[model samples]
Target: MGKGRAPCCDKSKVKRGPWSQDEDFKLISFIHKYGHENWRSLPKQAGLLRCGKSCRLRWINYLRPDVKRGNFTAEEEETIIKLHQSFGNKWSKIASKLPGRTDNEIKNVWHTHLKKRLSSKTNLNVDEAASKGSLNEEENSQESSPNASMSFAGSNISSKDDDAQISQKTFEHILTFSDFTEMLQEVDKPELLEMTFDIDPDIWSFIDGSDSSFQQPENRALQESEEDEVDKWFKHLECELGLEENDNQQQQQQHKQGTEDENSSSLLESYELLIH
Candidate 1:
């Protein structure tokens, strides 16, 4: 929050830069013995020569027992990417899903690692396609029979369709990242130091209305309102297909039941294997 009202102490008086092992031990022991009742009082109470903000950061990011250190696994990386893709610049929100990971750690990994990975993959794909040999009409005809040509044409169309869908998803992800970065800059201002996430539950329920099992009736109403807006094309298609609202409702019920059953069966089998 822009140095938190000039840090309330002289910069030279307080310890700065990376926290040392002794500082960590002192912080952890202090936290365990006295607890973090108040940040301002904590430093003096804990006998640390650091500001309250610095103490809090060191505790949360490093001293906290729950904070996972070391390298992120491939699975964790994938999870982080998917969560970021869904949540945009909500690094704290994404970090909540991943136990033991700090929001700052996740953010750094996204910026330094995941972004480079996606860029490289996109470049590699482009390079590979460019390296492929082009074919003349005669060569194309010679390489494939009429049936095969028809199949190839169909595949080409399908590939084009998938490319369009993928392009849209990629563009949305990029927009999300851009928007989040802009938001991060804005929120880092001095005025809005304290932010609330009380509306997140409401927002998430609205976005993922299809998962009715996880929502309350009040939340479901919000979900339905948003669903009405989000699935406009799907609703139009349903109407064109002459499917009534009741039919669609029944279909959703069946789909949910099938999914639940499959999940239960899978979990039960895993449990049985463990028991055996």
Candidate 2:
């Protein structure tokens, strides 16, 4: 309509319409024989009435041997969605991942199918904004007052506690499953248990496991320090156990008060039982 980039095709003497089957056969035969020498000059050379642009588009979009025309699969649709999410409107790049599917085909599929699917998920798309708003509110609350700072610190500690409790709950749930129970039984079976417990007896007796190796002076000092640490750990364990037993006895001695210490003692006993 607007003189159109100085007319690649001869506007005065070219034909344009739906290509005939004979026309398709001639175009295909010409391309196969001569390999489309020049698409601009192809219409005249090949004795086709269609414009070169139409010929090129037809060859590229439909008549090309490599063009794969079929129904899209579920897997292909999923791949398209993921590709689209990562690179919006990048039809050419998207087409590269999907063999035989042209950029034009990919673009059409996205417009007709994927675009509608995403349009229906507007609420899901806004969830990120909602989460961000919640985070900002938390920050503002934390910055409001001294009391708010203390409350935020308490919340941080509580969150850590919640995470630990949730992890423990999840572990318990997993342990309750039949497969996990079977796995536990397999691990606890006499042979497996013994194999796991039976470490190399001479493991700690070597410096890098070489029989004739002499330890460096620094290594000897470090080993001595570790020995002291082992002795200290044993002493600490004994002290803790003694304190726990004393606390239990005191809770029993003060049964009339029904105090927090008694509850703590009962909880510790339950923990010991569970561990065993």
Candidate 3:
């Protein structure tokens, strides 16, 4: 036999494979009325023959109210690809960043679709390069080709124009000092202000000022002094807000740790009872 104790649910008594409609309804109803903290005892209370682990998986992966179904969007696919590259196979961490997506769903999608797509693309690129073998010939053709030269020059000019347009549009949307101050005054939560300004301090130099026109020496000196004061005030606010966020995060982590400990103890006790 294996190292661990026998299964919690009696194989002979419990209904296995796909769950029936009645089982689904009962599980959902029971969980809705009373939460799923003590999963091992939940099946008996809910009149379910399924094991606690099965019930937990069903609720987490399929039956939850907030679970999103249907095809993934193009943006979501891109995000998954980027996150997968950075985090490797840590599906749970990646799922945390994507709301309504479970680790199981992401793992299935990656294995079924994205992985195959990437492999096919890589193979296609390799075949194309192999068929066009000589690097020297390719270079010579490019040097003598008027069409290639024109295409390259045109592409460079178009890329530069696109970049400039994007930069202008981005600058137009950047917050001015007056707008920032007004937002801070309007927001009720310190956390909101912290998130809004959670960027590099150096970017503050690009923030729009009240006056853009050239001014006399005396007026310019006064403007500089006022800007310095505003910068100091913003820095102080950011520091205080950061401290508040840290404290809140610490409290949340402590609570989560305690909850996990309690759940582990409950699960162990339930398992021992089942084994005995």
Q: Score every model by TM-score.
A: 0.43, 0.42, 0.44
Winner of 2 and 3 under TM-score: 3
TM-score of 2: 0.42
Which candidate achieves the best TM-score against the true structure? 3
Positional deviation of residue 178's Cα in model 3 after best superposition, in angstroms: 42
lDDT scores of the candidates, listed in order: 0.49, 0.49, 0.52
Q: Candidate 2 clash total?
A: 0
Tens digit of per-residue lDDT, candidate 1, span 141-163: 54454323211111112223453
Clash number for every model?
1, 0, 0
Relative to the unseen true structure, what is the C-alpha lDDT of residue 60 in candidate 1, on a scale of 0 to 100? 69
Q: lDDT: which is higher, 2 or 3?
A: 3
RMSD of each: 22.3, 32.0, 22.8
TM-score of 3: 0.44
Candidate ranking under TM-score, highest first, comes to 3, 1, 2
- Runs off by more than 4 Å, candidate 1: 1-8, 126-276
Off by over 4 Å in 3: 1-3, 126-276
Error of 2 at 270 (Å): 95
